[model samples]
Target: MGNAIHDNDSQMLYLKKRLNMFLEVLESVDPESTNLDDIDRMIEMVDDLEVKVHQFKKSE
Candidate 1:
């Protein structure tokens, strides 16, 4: 039980870090020069995050 809790905590930390990275990238983006590829990359990041979230939940 303790190990499971620790694993969950680690997963949460990883998720938090990933989210922060996404936010940092978003904040650094310049709207005036933003292109389709940038938008696609951001969408991909969100999708990856969503997948990790689901995986974390399933593990619990």
Candidate 2:
């Protein structure tokens, strides 16, 4: 039980860190010069975040 709790805490921390990184990238974007690749990258980030959330749910 204790190990499971520790795993959960670690996973949450990782997700939080990833989320902050995604937010930072978004904040740095310049909409005026944005292109297909930029949009694709953002979408990929969101998809990765979603996958991580689903994985966390399954672990619980």
Candidate 3:
């Protein structure tokens, strides 16, 4: 049980890091100056991270 909890916590931390990185990237980009493809890719990455986080929570 302890190991499971630890694993969950680690996964949560990783997810948070990914989210922060995405946010930084998004913030660094100027909406008017950035291309649509880059914005789409960032959005997709965030979506994927969210799905992973949800899966981790469900497993716990």
Number of the top-ranking candidate, with TM-score as the measure: 1
Error of 3 at 22 (Å): 0.7
Name the candidate, 1 or 3, with the larger TM-score value: 1
Q: After superposing candidate 2, which stretches have Cα over 4 Å from the reference? A: 1-6
Candidate 1 per-residue lDDT over residues 1-60, each given as its tens digit: 133423787999888988999999999999999999999999999999999898889888
By lDDT, who's the top model here?
A: 1
Candidate 3 clashes between residue pairs 3 or more apart in a chain or in different chains? none
Worst 10 residues of 3 by lDDT: 1-10
TM-score winner between candidates 2 and 3: 2
| Root-mean-square deviation per candidate | 4.8, 4.8, 4.8
Ranking by TM-score: 1, 2, 3
> Which is superior by lDDT, 1 or 3?
1
Better of 1 and 2 by TM-score: 1
